[model samples]
Target chain A: MEQHLVDCDLCFDALQVLQQQQYREKYQPLSASMQQYIRNSIKQVSHAHKAERYQRQEQKKESFLIYFWVVAAIAAGAGLIYLIQQQDKFKPSVTKAMASNAEIPAQRVEAPAVQAAVVTPVRAERADTLSHRPAPPAATTTAPVAPPAATPAPATPKPVIKDSVKAKTPAAVPVNKDSAKKQAPPATKPAEVKETVKAPAPEHKDTPTVAKKTEDKPEPKPVPKEKKDDDDDKPKPKPATETAASGTDEFLYKAAMVYHQQGDLNEAISRYKHLSGSSGKYGELSRYQLAVCYRSKGQTGKARRMFKEVVRMNGSMKDKAQAALDNL
Target chain B: MLQQLSNLSDKELISRARKLKDQEAEGVLMERYSHLMVAVCLPYLNNGPATSPEEIYPALLQRLSDSLKTQTIPKANEWIHYTIRAQQARTDKNSPFFPSTESREQQQIEARIEKAATNQKEQQQLIATIERTLDKLSAEEKYLLKEFYMNNKSFAALAETKQISIEKLRQTLQQAKQKMASLLMNETYE
Candidate 1:
């Protein structure tokens, strides 16, 4: 049989076919349950991919909302800082107007009759002071009024000198008439009258006598005493006039600022307009404030006009006025 | 629709599965390849009357599913073949029948027979001829073929059971194969 297989191709082929038949019988069909398991697994994998895609989209939407809120918070914080800086810019102008009002009583003494005569001259001087040396005049006036109690002490002797002046010139009598009315009861006391009559009467007659007494006094004491006398005798009437004018200007500016701060642009605009017309130290500042009020009120044309006038003046407010004009 | 899909080949079914996410296409692929996969896995199974298809089928499906995910249709078929070959090698290593020279010779013969048969009708005819020849053999010849070839028993152990020398057992197997070959030739002529 071995020799036949070696010699014949048909015998070899038949043996090979029989072996393949034995091997092919090993393959068996799968049961129904196994196929069902495979289908279920594929469905699970597909569902997982879809769920992951949905989660990714949700995360994207959430991140967008987070970024939007963060940006909105930053904008709100910036707006608050800008409002605070704007208020800070308005503060110094209000303070400057207040300081100028405080300096008024020392510079000018007001007698009602003299006030009508003195106000125009004081305004001219104040304008000149603002243009060249805004600080020095206020400093000079404040230095003299440093001791108000000392001023009254020095004023006691002035009526005596004025009484002698009345005796020398009948023209001086009407000027002392109000002083006499206030002093008549004191004048009836003989020792007080004698002391006053003795000290100042000779000084009035002889200029040398008054000069010797002023020189013999310690220098510092006499300087302020003379200043106090001058302030009491003549400048007293002018201070009242100065206070009335400066007080009104300060009040108007302060009220405008208050109204502006409170967002009442109309009332602030009216008060700032009145100050802008006045020839006072606050005129330039008030014009700038008026422009701000007009701008706030959305009256852009009026704001532009006021800012233009302030820019042309070459005043301390010119830079701010120019900035305002540029904004418009 | 399912009948049309079933008519398609494994490569065509895989393409439909990828393009349409068609469950039917995937089902058809599973059905078509399931028998081949089970045959590949059979040598790995423990020798018993009751072999668990449950354990083997899911593992086979899982490997095929993983291959489907990363591969295009053309490459997926190659991947399935490679995976089955690799699994067969691993199972072959631990098989009690490994190193059986007779089993190796039988496998070679089986490959040649399958190549020559070509179609189901010829293969079925060969199977019938083998069954007829196996029935005509002596009881001892049938027992030797069943134990050594089908059951993958070591020849030395088979020889020991038969109370024969190893040389005599080889002579008996050679004579049984020549008898089967002669019977097949006679049937072909008839």
Candidate 2:
């Protein structure tokens, strides 16, 4: 630049003028204001960029909040579904427990009917054979056979069972059946008579076969046996008729049948079970009806056992009990 | 703050303007060269509406300020001088200032000299390379370089000794300096 300045007269002249320090003063204030102008522009640009960045951050925050709410709602809905499903699991079990409670009491009542069906038929036969005894033969001529047979509690059902089993020859089974049919009261409802009319087959078969058995026995045993035979034949024909015609057990049984007809099976079962302990035409009938109550209550096992006991008694009800057992 | 800014080098001021976007640093840089701009522009002032002092000086400073962000300005004087001349011609308002190849080469050598200043071995090597390149120039360039740089003679005194117009002499000297800078730049690349 020092070498070039010698040849450039115009630049040399401009330099000489600037050496005076007068033109330097002229440009200074204009320079100051231009610098101020550029600084103002920088401030404006920086402020604008800062505002844009802040707006972007706020937009990001709002988007994140929206996502959070959507996830929260989905979680809450899932929780509600799970809660409902959990409750559904317990609901059916509660219903099943209530059903089981109802069935347990039903089973308890059926159990007693089953017991009475097993115990009472033999006792009723015992009571009928013993209660019809004439007072004198019951003491003397019939003492050998009647002493054991007439004992109230211990020996009575055994003798009655032995007599009933030994008495029903195949020949007499039909005869007793006919007697049971003839003896059903005309005043009774057909349903009660259906069981009662069938009641006397084993009773009649036992007496007639017993009389024949006494007649056929050895001479020494036959003498005492014929006395019992006379006592059983003479009074049993009349007293048995009297007992069958108007027995307390018969009326009680009619009441139980009414309850059975009314669809109050529990009451009917309790009544039948009560009469089931006595002996007469009605005792056998109550045992048969108790089995019907057990069947109605859906206690088929107990019903089957009760029917088997009635069949074991070999009564007129044996055919009906066998048919019921086959149905079960 | 302005006093502190005034004490910083031109490189620091340019960095503050471009990197830090410090408008005040830019203002200080423009102000530093304002007097030379006023002097250089004085001849063309009031020659036309486009050349008025009220219009040209501010427009010239603004043009330099705009170019400062994008341009590689190693030497502020050469860049500013080229721009002032470009603005004075008034042919293209939107045309940006660019440093010439010769100016860039000269700026590279200046940078190399500054880098080697603290290293005695590099400074000596640089001085030897400059001397060897000066020995390669034509007699007149060598003579003018010696007379102007060595003797510290003014441009007018050198033009008088050579018995030529100062304009032609200035052009020859400019070409000689350009040749030296290119040779130095090529030597560095090798």
Candidate 3:
């Protein structure tokens, strides 16, 4: 047989085949016990793999959700900041309107003696001619009072009134009315006292409306302050999730699925690049999907490369790889 | 074992292992090569009918698991053949096979397999020197030889698994046999 195998090519090949088959026939059957052992080992290994794969998928799913929530939280924070800034902008105008209404009563309280002096008849005729000329000065003084009337805080009330009094350089007489009422028995005049107390009602009406709004939606103060401090203490996490730029492999892999689902094929292809750099089970899947995407877009070269990658990186992907290769 | 092989496309066998998770596919793989285990155990049991293959199979299966753990053999075929020869020698020493040159040859075959022949040239030289010259082929060639030899697969099934035409598969295998004959020829010359 050896000599014959050496001399003739077909006979030699047949001889090797014949001997091998004889060996197989002699001892190929497994005993029941061996079969059980094999079955047990296989089951154990498969279960382990199934468990591990499930765990990996669960972890990936959890991470994906975490990333989504982080992005949502950042957007909500930005929106809230814009709202607060908008509210702050309008705050000064409302406060200014309240301040102006408050100042009107303080001016009214000081004019009682002047009104009493004008009530006498002989003196009133002489006073009427002088008062007519003085009316322009009085009108100018009232115009100067407008800005201080609108100022909100009483602590700054004196400075604003002083500036208004200065602007009406000739309205020094009404300021004297204020000082005189401050010094003398003007508060002692019964009718004037009643008028002075009543003037504060309109001023109070303007202030309470703004005070009610402040109470309704209390500002997020202490919480934002503590959060800001904690944010400072920790390294701020890359602004939570800024739409991670193009070309980052991890981000690209993650974003590829997102963009593909969004029907942005161009962007999906762009991100699939990161996925192709490494080849494994998931990587093979990525290539197969990418090829499908490319084929749908009529890009044969890229589709071919991706499909070929699946074949070259074959293991789990062998059938898919073969199919793609056959198609190509 | 069926699930594991089912998991792998014949193409997957060509790629480098990406992750150890691919080991899941090893189940059907063991089944595919389960008969080879008998070939391994048969040579070990000369006085076989009373001891029974059932009893011998558990120890052989344990050895298979141990072999996988050691990663000493890359392809299942090489490990199967080597284990058969090795186990036969151990059994012969303890149980008394032929009480002749059979024991010596089995020991020699085991030693030849164990000898480190790193490069293809050294390995081919060793195969020539060794009386049993089947050890020199590359991992893929070894697998084809076994599928053709131990499994008794049809040419079509072999071709399908190998992802080649049956004609091509036959030609490649014929070339492998020629190389084996050539190595055996070198043995006579040396």
Question: Among these predicted structures, which one has the highest DockQ?
Answer: 2
Candidate 1 lDDT over A1-328, as tens digits, reads: 4433332233333344334554345443343455566557555545457558669988999999999999999999999899888777556556644544444443344433343555333323333333224334443444465555446643532343333333433432332332332432333232243324323322222332233332223453344235534323333432335446566566668767877888978767766765675444576778889888888778999888888878776688989899889988
| Candidate 3 residue lDDT tens string, A5-120 | 22233333333433566544654344344556677866765666767877999999999999999999999999999999976654543343233234224323322333344223
**Residues A1-328, model 2: lDDT tens digits:** 6544543333455576566675666556644654465456445545456458668988999999999999999999999999888767444434433433454355445535643663244334433333333223433444565666665744654454455445532323344334443543432232243334335433444444543342222443334235533322323333335555344355567667767888989978887776564445466678889999999999998788878877876778989999999999
Error of 2 at B154 (Å): 3.5
* TM-score of chain A, every prediction, order shown: 0.29, 0.28, 0.24
Using lDDT as the measure, what is the rank order of every candidate, best first?
A: 2, 1, 3
Chain B TM-score, model 1, reads: 0.41
Where is model 2 more than 4 Å wrong at Cα?
A1-328, B165-168
> How would you encode candidate 1's per-residue C-alpha lDDT over B102-155 as one tens digit per residue?
333443545647776778787777787788889999999999877877787765
lDDT of 2 at B75: 64
Question: Which residue pairs show backbone clashes in model 2?
Answer: A6-B155, A6-B156, A7-B166, A7-B167, A124-A279
Candidate 3 docking DockQ: 0.11
List the candidate numbers ranked by TM-score, top first.
2, 3, 1
Worst 10 residues of 1 chain A by lDDT: A201-210
lDDT of each: 0.57, 0.65, 0.50
Query: Model 3, residue B105: what's the lDDT?
Result: 40
Q: Which CAPRI level is candidate 1?
A: incorrect
I-RMSD for candidate 1: 12.7
Q: For model 2, what is the error of residue A249's alpha carbon versus the real structure, in angstroms, after optimal superposition?
A: 60
Among all windows of 10 consecutive residues in model 3 chain B, the one with the lowest summed lDDT is B94-103
